[model samples]
Target chain A: MALDMKLFKDVKTIAHAGMDGLIFYFSGEPVQANQRVQQYMLSINHAKPDWLKTLIPSYDSLLVCFDCFKVDAHFVYQYLAAHELTHAVSIDGSHHQIPVWYDSPQANDFEQIKNQTGLDKSEVIKLHTSYSLQVFAVGFAPGFAYMGELPEELVCPRLATPRKKVPQGAVAIAEKQAAIYPFSSPGGWNLLGLCPWYYELTDPGDLPEFSVGDSVSFYAINEKQFTEMANDR
Target chain B: MTDKLPIGFVIEDPGLCAIIVDNGRDSGLDRGFSEGGPLDETAYFWSNWLCGNAEGEPAIECIGSIAFTVKARAAIAVTGPDVTLTRNGNACPSWQTLNVEPGDKVTAKSLSPTAKVYLAMSGKWLLNEVMGSAGTMMREGTGGLDGKGKPLDSGDCIPIRIGDADKKEVPNWLQPDYHSNEPLDVVPGYQFEHFYPLARRRFFSADYTVTSDINRMGYRLNGPAVTSDVQNMRSEGINMGAIQFPQDGQPIIMLRDRQTLGGYPKIGCVAPYDIPRLVQQQVDGVVQFNECAASDARTKWLLAKSKRVRYLTEK
Candidate 1:
């Protein structure tokens, strides 16, 4: 079945302008915005129509990189436009609960959050652990996903000086965004907790664990579980 | 297994920083893998051309100088910057193929003016392709011979697959004039309109000096602050040679090793053909940016590519 052609105007406009790539800006009520874009991309991917090459959706934007050699930008642009016009409703109910170790000392920004929120360590953990964050985008580092919309009280700015080395599996918050560092590297985000789950670099042939539209809810895990998972790998 | 040759390089003395590289792995950036390639691309292409190697074959990107003793006779080419090459104490021409006898010593000198150099050999180097690329991404611990990005060290032996004795010479027309330093061409970006008109005017007109803070990631420039009136915006996918103006107002030209995305307001991207000049510039060397039509840039790119293709096939 052909995707609605009108949805692709933006794609055409961008391609005609000679842009190698284009970022689509999506806006919906905050409550359903994340699910809307996610479902849109998934449906496009699952349908696997011959014309579409790649359809990537983030929290508020969808990046579509087309095969210029096979299909012109206009074709891809029309596909997106038709798809968006036909599927306007939110696609809800695909959620994942990710286990995080908030109490671990390796959680780099624990003390700073306590100091800023005027909440004791326990209160900070409770606030962070309870909230279900929507996966806003997967970027910055490979498999490094940005999950966000933290509880207002737990909202914290990034560290004044970014740590030279933020350990892998670090769960950090910057502004309204909370992210897990899939790999150890330099980061400026304020640390809150550590997730035992490996977000990146799976062995060849292994399925990619996370999708752009998936929701990841963090649950506190004990040190034993963290070690067991680490050893299991 | 017997047919598979071991790719290795024995470093007599590790030059400033020499490492094995190939066409960077397709990171599946569509799924989030940053494209990592050589810092100096023009030289990278020339190096590959010298040895008649196909594009993406593994080569050595030497930062300063690379001295090595070849255990087996091989055909190799050295390109990039302005570096002197010597084989067993006899001076050799840069940008040409040479037949290195077994046990011969190859030494490369530091760039007198440019920043990096490239050395390529015929036949694929016997190295493992990490994430589908041999190029090293040290920051991500991906790519390179071991899949852990590390510069070549003393005593590291790189094995090369031997090719049949099919020799081709590089024509004089195909050789690039390393001395002809040119200004980079840029196409204004989305945020270019946000900069103060004066800042925009100055950007195209003024001269900016490159700083020592240059690397695979980015080149920090020292020049008059190109101020902007726009506030901080969300980070976006940055292209290679993206000229970004941070809060300090000094522009940072992102390079090969640059992050996948950035939030800084970008003025625009430098044309791919112009990147070689930018990459090779010495610290404090003055550079100016000239805006060109996209069609014009594309035509230039095609012309350059055609010339390169002719050079490759002529020999």
Candidate 2:
């Protein structure tokens, strides 16, 4: 099909995110408001509306929820403002690469992020594996994520006390963001190492090798390729 | 063969914080999970319709003094807030239906301190449903009955499907009072007009206390700060009983293991039929809040789903 392009065109406010949800709001840039919230979550999850249920998508809105006994929020804001964000087709998610290790031993703030970004440790793994970022919010846990801009000399600042554990796939950063955690909780970010990949759901549409407008990249491995990808996980 | 025989129950003690909930985990909120269910959805739908099950099935929940046992003939119930239950030691009746068998036992006992209970049984447990939810989610360790989300301790077991009893009860207009001081309601809606209308009239004329920093992801109140001129925005989706705030504006609420995404400033949600009386109140208790409209919270969730479809079609 291939030709449906009008996009959230800066919609601004749909509101209500409560009595059975419905956020929307689009006002621009954060990669075009998460590419119009991943094209309105791929056209309302491909119009599967049995009064939808949960859609979520963040970094600039698209909550949704529905099904208060089959609809409301003004019939889901007039079926999402009478549709038309166009889509002959768009997909673009899953991009990964990952593989960190940034000198593992969970790189406990590798010398306090090389003295708060004066950039050492191989220029903070060459500006955190130079560009690819963009997940911008998976959440505060479960395959964590939140990746982003960074590179203003590798940002920094988080961990004024917050590390009661932080192990699983660690790799972190703060300010302009970058993350990884994905299950070994209690973290305060700023770590910088160990990414033998983690998060594991196993069904109910599984997901999470990366999500939320996905696109990763990192790449620096060692410590025996993080012990052969943590013994091939 | 009699629904492949197995039946459930085992945890002989568990006590403070049992788990295995249900009707949660779907589309794991875009990969961050936390919809672990039943922080008192009307005492988990009257403990799954007084154990004739299916008000979202899979049960247990608990909090402070559990027990368990059974493993053959079943049918259960319990419901919460000021819990009690009992069984082998006799005293039964929390919201009705009981009948056990095999090793029997039962237990429950919270009596307050913001109870929590639930239990529910009557068939269909056979666990395994991780992200589609057999619900435990000890903060994403994942579902339960050893799907690894941990919590119901002392021996474990679970499995299910043998059911029987049929006794039921719970009618005093489907019981749920938990000492009803009432207020709660609140269908406000995200950022509810960017606050400051005297901070939404001190959030519906303030009272708020409940803060032992509650759990199952949120509750925290403490009272009237409200603020919200909407600063750093962008980070959204949150809903269950929502409320939010935090910049010392104190609020919190968002339960059923919350955190799917946030950025503070919420001032909404709450009316899911008053989120099980504010998750059964009691830390320092005291609550209040009102404004409900959104079609009167969808006609109080369609009259509580038409009283669970007229008590499951008159049983």
Candidate 3:
């Protein structure tokens, strides 16, 4: 059976990702791709099928994981073709205004980013927080959000050699994206400063504060405020 | 309150790596958490089944040599590839339940680094589930004994509900053959057709060796490099057992502990039923890929799952 042309206008391909996974490759810009992802997520979540397990959203695709014992890729494919995703309920996400301690001691790459972007430390921080950024994806590590469309002047390449250990809560940028390291893992992004906020998994219901398509903006904070705020948490 | 007293085993030696694992978490994929669980899931379930515990009960997944001391009478089982089980210096059989007395010493040793061993005890393991799973994600630092994703260490005592478990053994017909050399089945998807026909052909025909660079995250296979024509692709969500061909051509099968997203072009994903065979393969073990239809792959997966459930209920 073929996919419905009317329902799958943005879907470039509805193919088997694996035995238990089906991927929906979307066409168009990142914004449109994410919209398609949100629509599918909403439609699938509304149904709350037992076979459906997880939905992963990326920049240009949506991966749907199902219980292989209950359903096959074909079943999911046909289900997707039948679901009227266009009528999915669209809802607003929470807006997060995070605080960052720029020029902190953890900002080892501050000078490097300044040299690469041809901007001063304060200017770099301004460009980063100038406009609200959208979370394009969340991966690489737990709660490591990939927020995008960084200002052109702030775009910088990843380090040629990644550091062995990047501190947790490190605010960083690379290419056209900015992110925070929720855990102290090896990373290559240019570190601008550290954020007071972080994601920690303590309970089954614990989730990252942000999800894909959520809007986030950062504000500069002094080290004293960063320390006090961190301690308070 | 008296029944709630801690009763279990203490790790005497954690050799190599050992961590507590369960069936794994179904959620947290969107938040960038991989579905961390036992690498060799077939043996993991068997280990639990022999102990009369639910197949998804939290068990200990270990590599290399591990030794533990029981603090209370309990039934335990170990299963893995090329593993030697010993109880108080006397060699014991694996894949069957063994009753141990207090202060009894049990050890499991795997000669190969490529394979892992699983140890499951009767009764429920006392662990706080994270995201509905006790399976440990070391990278994410979630789940496990302390819910910090730390591997089992010497002197670490694991608490459990001590209960009577009858003597049981897995039927011979149900035991998995870890030595099988059959080619793993792959259900091609995501940029599969974009790969040149010759590249695709090479992937199926070529022999890939399981490189030493293997872990819960992924296995880097050394073989013919199959390059894809698709370039400048946006990073997207990666599925478990997804076969990715980076710029260098060698295929990397993303496993349970893989990152939530990746940018490399993928040819397809390895069938879930064949993943155990791939994970159990020793380093330098030759592996080949065979194309399988998605429907056929799904049937195989369902059959395996049903077989396990059938045996679990029947026995």
DockQ (CA atoms), all models: 0.21, 0.22, 0.47
Q: Which ten residues in a row have the lowest lDDT in candidate 3 chain B?
A: B1-10
C-alpha lDDT of candidate 3 relative to the true structure? 0.81
Clashes of each: 17, 1, 1
Judging by lDDT, tell me the better candidate of 1 and 2: 2
Structure candidate 3, residue pairs in collision: A204-B131
* Candidate 3 ranges with C-alpha deviation above 4 Å: A1-7, A86-131, A151-166, A173-175, A186-208, A218-233, B1-4, B306-315
Best by DockQ: 3
**TM-score, cand. 2 vs. native:** 0.36
lDDT per residue, candidate 3, B1-315, as tens digits?
324558699999988889998888778777787788888888898898888897699999888778999998899999987788999999998889999999999999877765689998999888888777887778777788768888878988888887678898877667667778888999888788889999999999999999887889888899888987775466678888999876668788988888888767898999877888889888899999999988888877777778878887786
* Model 1 per-residue lDDT tens digits across residues A21-103: 34454456443555555556666766666644344454555555444434554565656667643344443536887777766
Q: Write the per-residue lDDT of candidate 1 for residues B178-291, one digit (tens) a residue.
A: 456566788665466678989988999889998877777788898888877655244445566778886678888877766665556677778777777777777788899888
Give the poorly placed runs of model 1, Cα more than 4 Å off: A1-19, A29-57, A62-126, A151-164, A196-208, A219-233, B1-9, B112-114, B165-181, B196-199, B224-235, B245-248, B313-315
Ranking by TM-score: 3, 1, 2
TM-score of candidate 1 relative to the true fold: 0.80
Candidate 3, position A118, lDDT = 83
Q: What is the per-residue lDDT of model 2 for residues B115-225, given as tens digits with 9 covering 90 to 100?
A: 787788787777788668888887677678777677888877777866555787777676667688979888777788888888889889889899786888877788768
User: For each model in turn, which proportion of the native inter-chain contacts is also found?
Assistant: 0.12, 0.57, 0.71
